[model samples]
Target chain A: MVYELYYWPGIQGRGEFVRLALEEGGAKYIDIALKPENRGGGVPAMNKFLEGPRVPHPPFAPPFLKVGKQLIGQTSNILLYLGGPLKLAPRDEAGKLWVHQLQLTVADLVVEAHDTHHPIAAGLYYKDQKAAAKRRAEDFREHRIPKFFNYFEKVLTRNRTAGPWLVGRRVTYADLSLAQVVAGIRYAFPKASTKALRKHPRLMKLHDAVFERPRIKRYAESGRRLAFNNDDLFRNYPELDG
Target chain B: MVYELYYWPGIQGRGEFVRLALEEGGAKYIDIALKPENRGGGVPAMNKFLEGPRVPHPPFAPPFLKVGKQLIGQTSNILLYLGGPLKLAPRDEAGKLWVHQLQLTVADLVVEAHDTHHPIAAGLYYKDQKAAAKRRAEDFREHRIPKFFNYFEKVLTRNRTAGPWLVGRRVTYADLSLAQVVAGIRYAFPKASTKALRKHPRLMKLHDAVFERPRIKRYAESGRRLAFNNDDLFRNYPELDG
Candidate 1:
């Protein structure tokens, strides 16, 4: 059976990380929310699984995966489940945990990116807290992004043999998620991320290399993949970009 | 062999979640950063392991558990590793992921709590970012905390048979970490959290229940259980409290 993937339809958001795994590994899955409601899709369809009586383990938010009777949420948790089947993670337990840890850190960076646009509150609109976002973006663009870049660079430096991938010698979910992060960051903060990306050649190389992957490149070119926009996480509010 | 846990000394922080698992489960471990430098433990000791050549899997930050040559970081990551041997998580893979999802949400709340005080810059002190923090805390106090409380309350309500545990009948690491979040929130925003906590009696019960566990209660009363202070993730800065 094709796994059912639930997430908001329009944006890459966190769902893209899971999407990359399925796409790159050629897993059979349906983007449940993207389909028509009559055919058991749309927000309401996703909501049923979220709070439906059938699902004992309700997801707090979307980007949850459904297979048979089992449902899993949290981007990293879903990746962990899919990693082995997809062979996108290491075989050893320690190796799996290492990849998961890196993805969790990527999740942290994603949160920071969202905060840059919505510093005062995620519930509030960008215009409502524009000033706070401006200041917050400065810290994110200057301090936070660079700190993350440096940390990842160090991780890569420590494992030069691995080259492009963040962990070990093979491409893992961590690399896929990191590639998404670089894309989002580059889209959202073109000027700032350009300079920042330049500082880490290995990271930039990984970004280019991930995009160069036949499957990933085809998926990106395939219009099935959504583009990053102002409405999503890692939005490019020109004013917020220092 | 006793596990070597490397986290910053003098604060409960994220490490406490790991420490709670060890203390409550009665696992043998050392708080590496807390030991004297003369005896081969301190910030340097922790830093050495962070970037150490011997560690095949170097963690991005502390609160990493060192077992033989493998170093696992990230509070939840460490908890996931320790949960098995400690039997603090469920036996089934699906059940384990469920508990972990709850913990990751707890981790989200922790990040939100930390951001309330340092909305502008983590590198900057609370004193330096008080204004932005004031606005951020208001949103957190009014919207964020209640949302998280309601979500957890719903989770607990769904698993009423489990009572205070949040999962099934047994007390998993999620319950332990959640109890820490409740305590830290109460300590940081006494006025707001008190009013908020009243709405989620089940969660309040879970908080009380976890604290009342024999080993947990002993750990709390023990001088080794560090007090929550301004320097930590959940600090009671009276000015920031809404």
Candidate 2:
């Protein structure tokens, strides 16, 4: 059976991680929220799980996955569920834990990236919090971008035995997610990300390699693939970027 | 062999969640960073695993668990590892995933609580970002606290078959973490938390019940249980609180 994936139609947000993995794995799944509400999908269908009585395991928020009878939520958690079957993680217990650790760190960076524009509140508009956003974005683009990239770069450098992959020789979900991070950073802070990448060739190389993977490359060109925009988690505001 | 848990000595931070599990389970483990440096068990010992040559599995940060030769990081990841052995998680796969989902949500709240005082960056001091923090804290206190609690409250109400615990009648690591989250919030935003708790009796009762557990109670009063302070994730900044 084709799995069901639910997320906001307009933004990649956390859902893109799951979508990338699914796309890479060529996994049979439906992007439920991307469908029209008239077809019994989209935000209204997703809300049923949020507010409906039948959903004993209602997600705190979306990008939730429905595999058979199970409903899984949380980006990292969902990635974990997909990683095994998708071969996006290692087979060993230790490797799984390590990959998960890397993924969790990626998640940490993702949240910080989101906070750059929405430092005060996710509910408020960027204009309302521009002052705070400026400071937050600077801190993010400066201290955080380097720190996180440095950490990943270190992880990549240290794991030579496993090749260029974050955890192993194989392209796991972490690499795919890293590709997204790099793209998001470049899109949102072109100048700063360009400056940051100038000294981090290994990171740039990994992002390029992940993007070039046949399935991912094909998906990127596919009409199903959405472009990064102001409405998404990684919004490009000229004033906010360094 | 006993597990070797490493974290910064000064703060409860993320390590406290792991500490509570080991303490409650009466598990044989050494809180490495908490020990005196003279005995080769302080930050130096922890740093070895982080930066030293001996560690093939260097952690990004502390609160890592070393079991035999394996190293695990991330609070929720470590708990997910310890849950089964500690009998703090359900036996079924679905139940375990559900428990983990709850734990991740608690982690989300923990990060938000920390950000209330340091919204600009963790690299920056609270005083440096007080203006942003006040705004962030107000948002957290007014919007996030209720939204998060309301979701959990709904989960608790929905999962009545499991009894009072978040996952089931059994107290999982999530409950322990929830207990910590409550304590941290109360310590940081006593007035706001008090007001919030007035409307969240179920959450308050869960917090109290977890704290009152014989093992947890003994551990809390033990001298090893550090008091919440400014250095910790949840600091009582009067200006930031509602």
Candidate 3:
């Protein structure tokens, strides 16, 4: 059965991490919220999942995946579960744990990225919290971007077996996650990411390498890989960037 | 061998979650940074782990537990690992996963709690970002607190077993973590939590039950349990709470 992925339709958001893995692995899946009849052409299905009582273990929010009877939420947990089946994770327990750790870190970075635009409240409009968002964006660009990017770069450099992939020779979920992060940063803060990439050669190479992968290339060009915009985590706010 | 816990000495911070589990289970462990000759104390140890030579899998941040040679970080991951040996988690996979999901939700709340104070940057002083922090804190108190508390309340209400524990008929990490969250909320937003508790009877019952547990009672009474202060995740700011 195809995995049912439930997330916001338009932007890649957190769901993109899961989507990339499924896309690159060529897994059979359906982006449920994007479908018309399934969701009644809106986010009601996603809302129903959140408010519904049928799920014994209900997800707190979206970007959740349904595999058979099991419903898994939390972006990192979803990736961890899919990693083995999709061949996006290492075989060994230690390596698998490492991949999960990397994914969790990526999740952390993603949260920080989102906070750059909506520091005050997720429910509030960006215009309502512009001042706070501006301050948060500055901190993100100055501290968080460098801190997270440098850490990933170090991991890439430190990996003795594979210089590019986060864990081993295989392209695990971490690799796909890194690629998306790089792409988001470039779209959001072109100048900062360009300057940051110079210090992290291996990370830059990995970002370039992921795009060259046949499946990933197809996914990127298929229009399914949504472009980063002001609506997503990596918003290109000129004032926030500098 | 005793488990090695590495976190800053003063505040309960994130390390408190691990500390509570260890205390309840009566696990043999040492809070590394609290001891003398600890090689420049907790801050140094934390920074070293973060900025030091890259391990095969680097932890994003501290509150990591070292059992033998394996170094595990991330609060939920550490709790999940310790939960088994400490008898703080369910033996069954499904139960374990549920508890983990609950713990991850707790981690999310903890992040939001931290953001209330340090909305702009972890590196910046709270005073420097007080304006932004005020707005962020308002949203947290008004929106996040109720959202998280209500979700957990529903989980407690939905448990068919009628058990106080989140999973089965036993106290798992979720129960302990929930107790801590309750305590933190009470400290941080006494007025708000008092009002909110009226609507969440099951959660309050669980909190009351956890407080009566022998080990937890001892831990709370002992000088070891750090008091809630401005330094911790849940802090008192009258303006923010209102």
- Local error of candidate 1 at A227, Å? 0.9
Model 2 C-alpha lDDT per residue in residues B61-101, reported as the tens digit of each score: 87899999899999999998999888899989788888888
* Superior candidate under DockQ, 1 versus 3: 1
What's candidate 3's DockQ score?
Answer: 0.59
Worst 10 residues of 3 chain A by lDDT: A37-46
TM-score of predicted model 3? 0.94
lDDT values, one for every candidate: 0.88, 0.88, 0.83
lDDT per residue for candidate 3 within A1-242, as digits (tens), equals 69999999889888999999998889999888888955463588778778887657788888889898788887877887788789999887667767877777887888888888888789998888888888888888788888888888888877889457888888999899988888888888888888888988888999999888899999989988888878887888878778
DockQ, prediction 2: 0.73
Q: In candidate 2, what are the lDDT values of residues A1-242, reduced to their tens digit?
A: 68899999978788899999999988999999888889988899889888887688889999899999899999988988788889999998778888888888899988999999999889999999999999999988878998888777778777766456787688999899988989998999999999988888888988999889999999989867789999998999999886
Distance (Å) between predicted and true CA of B213, model 3?
2.2
Q: After superposition, how far is residue B22 of candidate 3 from its true place, in Å?
A: 2.0
RMSD of 3: 2.0
Worst lDDT window (10 residues) for model 2 chain B?
B50-59
Give the lDDT of residue A19 in candidate 3. Answer: 92
> Candidate 1 residues B47-86, lDDT tens each?
8977677555677787889888787888888888888999
Residue pair clashes in candidate 1: none
